[model samples]
Target: MTSPEEALQQARATYEEHARTCRQCHFDAVPCPVSKHLLRAYNNARREQMRANSGVR
Candidate 1:
């Protein structure tokens, strides 16, 4: 199983790469469907890491 930190890092990198290439990912504006999915993945990874750090299931 991947560690929470690793998962978060992977998710962040994936999202960042997409945002870098995709024109619809303006930080100030609404994201495209793909961007939205990626953002959700990143956020979920982040939350999982936080939960792990806090010893929460």
Candidate 2:
């Protein structure tokens, strides 16, 4: 079991890495808003899950 803080840190790092590449990827460019939304939701969910789990433990 990873500590909540550690898990959050890892999640943030991964999201940051994706953000760097997302802006430049042709697949992620202007025509697609879907990927951006998906990524946002994913990050939010991960953070929420971490918070919930952290609180419980």
lDDT of 1 at 23: 71
TM-score, one value per model:
0.85, 0.44
lDDT of 1 by residue, 1-57 (tens): 999999999999998888887876756455789988988999999999999999999
> Residue 36 in candidate 2 has what lDDT?
64
> Candidate 2 residues 1-57, lDDT tens each?
865566666766755566666755445455245446556755775776777877863
Clashes of each: 0, 0
Candidate 1 lDDT (Cα, 0 to 1): 0.89
Candidate 2 least-lDDT 10 residues: 25-34
Model 1, position 8: C-alpha lDDT score:
95
